[model samples]
Target: MKNKNVFNYLKQLHADNAEYKEQMAELKKLPHEYQVVYKEIQNFLWEFTSGDGMDMLQPMYGLLDFFKEGAGNQVPVLDLVGEDVGEFAETMLHEIQAKTRINELKRKMNERVKKEINQNK
Candidate 1:
């Protein structure tokens, strides 16, 4: 059973790698500005990566597609990302909900407050 689980994991990992390569190839076809912005956003978000970070890939894939369509219509990268980049990245992190450190801290703080209130009651 343990071996089977390992095999399954390896299979999924290989498939994911292949998909990532394909995504990268597609990304390369985009304009330089788009590529630079994409890499910047990717690096920023990676710092906040939670767990294995597999949850983050789906959003990135979507972001790439959105960028592609916008680029196709001649939309500037800055326009797609807005004037504020960091805020945009934070917003994306919130939407991902991958049990980040900030989220964990918030959860802990709430629990502590709840416990305190109950004890006082």
Candidate 2:
């Protein structure tokens, strides 16, 4: 059972990793300025990774999406994130952290409900 669990975990990880790579490839194709700023924001957010650090990924993807939209519109990178990029990163971090907390609460609630249903059966 343990081996099965580990295999499943690894399988899911390998599958999901491809998507991350794709996002990175898209980032690479972006304008040099956007690439530089995205990497900077990515590094800044990484410093605050919680536990397994998976939560940081969502914000990064969001940032990439944001950059992609801006690039599509031909907006300057500075205009996209403002002159203070650090401030922009902090705002994203705050939003993701808040979202993480809310997700945890929802997960706990669902687990409790699941437990109750299991017990009733």
Candidate 3:
């Protein structure tokens, strides 16, 4: 007789791995800053993975609004299962914008400091 338990376990493992690979591929397609944001959101989602679906709803809706602001309004929230994966995508978009703004401020501040030092020299 076939060992159905081991066979099922192996099959399930393969399916899980495939899903992970697909998600990785999607992340790789994003710009570098957005990829960093996606990973951060992934970490945030990790904690809620074992929690109830209700717990994720608030965060998911917050994420959906982030997407809606950025042209991802078309992303279907209902079609997503478990914790909404849209959170990862949308958070990345918003985070990347924030990072860009911060970087610009840093550059301007650095330029001012350099100008001050050059004047003192």
* Per-candidate local distance difference test: 0.87, 0.85, 0.51
Q: Is candidate 1 or 3 superior in lDDT?
A: 1
lDDT of 2: 0.85
Q: What is the TM-score of each candidate against the true structure?
A: 0.82, 0.76, 0.39
Q: At residue 25, give the lDDT of candidate 3.
A: 69
- Report the candidate with higher TM-score, 1 versus 2: 1
Ordering by TM-score: 1, 2, 3
The reply for model 3, stretches above 4 Å from the true place, is 51-121
Supply the TM-score for candidate 1.
0.82
Give candidate 1 regions above 4 Å deviation. Answer: 104-121
What would the per-residue lDDT of candidate 1 be over residues 1-121, giving only the tens digit for each residue? 9999999999999999899899989999999999998888888777777667676788889889999999999999889889888888888888877766666678889999999999999
* 1-121: candidate 2 lDDT, tens digit per residue: 9999999999978877887899999999999999999999988877776455567776788889999999999999999899999999888877776445446667889999999999999
lDDT of 3 by residue, 1-121 (tens): 3789889978976876685676566556544544554455655654434323233333544543443343244433333222555654455445434333345567789999999999999
- lDDT of the structure predicted as candidate 3: 0.51
The candidate that wins on TM-score is 1
